[model samples]
Target chain A: MERKNLVEMVNIHKWFSGVCALRGVDFSVGYGEVVGLVGDNGAGKSTLIKILSGVYPPDEGKIYFEGKECHFSSPREARMLGIETIYQEAAMVPKMSVMRNIFMGRELARFRVGPLAYLDIPRMEEESMKALERVDLRLRSPHAPVDELSGGQRQGVAIARAMYFKSKLVILDEPTNNLSVKESERVLEFIRELKKQGISSIFISHNLYHVYPVADRIVVLSHGEKIGDFRKEETSVEEITKLMVLP
Target chain B: MRHTLLFTLRRALLLREISSLIMLLVVILVFFALSPLFLSRENVGVVLEIIPELGIVALGVTMLMIAGEFDLSVGSLFAFCPIMISLFVSEGIHPILSIVLALLLSLLLGGLNGFVTLYFGIPSFITTLGTMLIWRGAVLLISGGWPPPFSSALPTAFLVGRMGIFRASILWFAGITVLLWFVLERTDFGNWMFATGGNQVAARAMGIDTGKVKLANFMLCSLLAGFAGVIQSFRLETTLPSMGGGLEMEAIAATVIGGTALSGGVGTVIGTVIGSFLIRIIDNGLVMARAPSYWFRVFIGIATILAVILNTFVRERARKMRC
Candidate 1:
């Protein structure tokens, strides 16, 4: 079987202020594969994902998506290229409704009538309902304030949003960070579901247990350098944890 | 069945505008009971007359507040625009042309407010406050601390003339309210406004230009403020140097009373219209009831605090009910 890369970063480097966040590092995710990126604090896992998400451009590197070299100047540009990023804290506005959160920047507007084009409320509500249904997440209403949702359900909403948008690569930055044990399991299950749908995911987390079961491959970083890469059958959680702790 | 009832009840009280509507009705009733004169046609007309200028300015402030920004300069620009118009008209410019020039200048003022804040990375509150003082000083200097007189039947008739018992400014106010309500409620741009204020970083991540939305809001605020100034001047047939002073506070208070969050991202145009009316009617009603001039301000202050307290309590209940 030919193993093709869906996303590839070649010798990426990043610096914040004067401190180096990511030294020379290379990372990739294969099509329909869940790549678990694990690291301790200050390991540059976030910087790498941020680069991929277009939160910050790498000071030095090349990024190829779907076999095409791409330069994304902004997160919007990155999203337009089908790269969706779910940040830990900033995924959705708390005060806004779930439907509004689903269509925040990419709202569906009715065709222009006279000089005005209005929000297609009914269509958005219907589509949001369908998207949430795809994730098997049931909300009291699509109009419920997102702040009212449990941490786990919020992750579901974010996942559903990416799935509905047909994103090629969904980057989950600590998707299960603050969720309960059961909710964390749900996120892991959702990742497996994504693999079944041919959608690739880069699942970033600090917990090996959270990522190990669902990930097809585990990538480890220590002090901003790629320390270990292993297939599920090639390594144990103990070994990966050791790699993350050691320089 | 209990779940559905909670949802429905939550929706009703959680809606900020509905509460404001209730407040407006209650205020009117109380005022009418205290002074039968409050409900009289002539007294109602007088209250209506006081509303358009204050309401227009408040409309601009409400949108800016919704976008998570403030424009203290609106009142100064409101006074300045009329001064500019009167100066131009006195110098042999056509009244309509003078009005247009004044409005164009107002757009610049608005742009400056947005640009200074964005460029310096300062809070808009501070930036607009600075501009407010500067523009107010500019108005005084240009007018020599005196009101400018005018006598133009055409400009007056067009901008502020009576249509039956109501002034033309009231029509402009209603027209603006309708237009802004449509923009805020129905348009994609309105969604962007809420998103921008709701979470600017998230908004930017999703490809929305949060900066542009806020800048446009600032400009719209100034344009409306200028329009109010122009209307008021044409109505009075003169421009007072003291006009529009302290009006920014009134506008901000009204917007908050309308349930626009001070932190931004949540507001309604209908709520703001009711809020504006509630504030202005109290001011008029107090005068009719023979209260001292200073008493109205105390009442306004108390009313604003109470309105916000009431709104927050209701919203909290709804949130608790949601769980």
Candidate 2:
């Protein structure tokens, strides 16, 4: 039985300064399935994902999220459709406390006094603590600044935020980049947690070893085109690496 | 138990304003010891009077600095606003109506500053610096480079009247501070402001309109500066072309001394008040001590630098003490 697709990008084309970045690429991610997107530098992987995540408009193509055709002008629009993208660095304010970072734009407010709404600090702090715990990050306090957290822990907080928001599909861009070996394993464990919760993920990475273990299916891009797509059991790691390296 | 005690002490001392608070105390004590008249009721009143005018302007600067913007135009607006009001009042408009018109004029000037900074994508310092020069020059052209004298009986009595030891301007300063403090600490807009200043990219990623937050802060900064100028002019019954000259730096200094980071995202309104008061007290003490008036600027520069250094030392030590 074929799995239902949560997101579908059909015949997508993108260009920049008369240069083709993506040419007629078709990609889809099924519900609760991990699709590892592997490519060398300048292989159009980043452009394709940016289009799907609404960072840029596709020159030609249609995107369907949850079977509904969607056009997103900004990342916020994509996020509203339950798609959260965690770019490398986890994209958090360093000076703000962990809890504040978790609920940065979407703050919980209580007791409307005239035109002002007081922030519900206790509730946010409690929820932030639980989210951090769910991702298995043991920080000293929710009040600690994000800059103090280890790289792995920071990624965990981003994952925890996505999880708590109940995003249907999360796109992790180089999630394990610059992380320790143990930290990479922790991120792998997080992907497992997402899978257990019936959420789909698009894991983009340069390392085949990292992608091969958790991916249900693999998609390879080379020189601005889709080169290959293979199921985990059918394709060997060497084959995928060859597809990535040899255009 | 001992570990917890050390932890608690470090945490308390590590706050951005604690060092400033200690420094303020030391300065006041030193002044009191050096001069018998430093603690006199009349001298205390003098410090209180000067503090509120600069303090009100500093409050607005504190928020803008935290939101990661600057308005050098504040000093210019402070000089220009009252002149505009007196011009209208002399032209047969009621003083009340003139004040209203002046504030509206201030809003327009502020909006212009904000628009150029946001829409054109120029740094606020450059935009406001341009505005500073424009408004100051405009005031000079309008007033013929001379101070204008115009007084309203009821308005002056109400705004500058003595409320026992403290003046009405001091009340205005304190009231505005409390209102702003609540807004900064308790409101969603306040949080967004911090996020915008702390990290614009991340804040935008989180779906915040950082540009809007910054524009609003610029407007607020101008409005407060204008309001402070109106109050000062009403009390003095004259709008000096030189009035508020070099005040922008003083307000910025007060903000930095009060523990607000020049980089933004880390400041408190109360801290700015203390910072403003500290500078005022020092200025007052220096005058009473018969120090050269230029000594005031020299001391302010030293205080600002020292406060930041001490605050950083305490913060780093606090982090190190933590497990």
Worst 10 residues of 2 chain A by lDDT: A1-10
The TM-scores, one per candidate, come to 0.96, 0.97
Interface Cα RMSD, each model: 1.4, 1.5
- Which runs in model 2 stand beyond 4 Å of their true positions? A1-3, A113-115
Q: Which has the greatest lDDT?
A: 2
Off by over 4 Å in 1: A1-3, A113-116, B1-8
Q: What DockQ results for candidate 1?
A: 0.71
lDDT of 1 by residue, A1-247 (tens): 1337989899999988988988989999998989999999789999999899887899998998888888888888889888999987788888889998899878888877664578899999999999998888988789988888888899899999999999989999999887889989998878877787899999999999999999999998888898888998999988888777775
Task: In candidate 1, list every pair of residues with a backbone clash.
Answer: none
When candidate 2 is compared with the true two-chain complex, its DockQ is 0.73
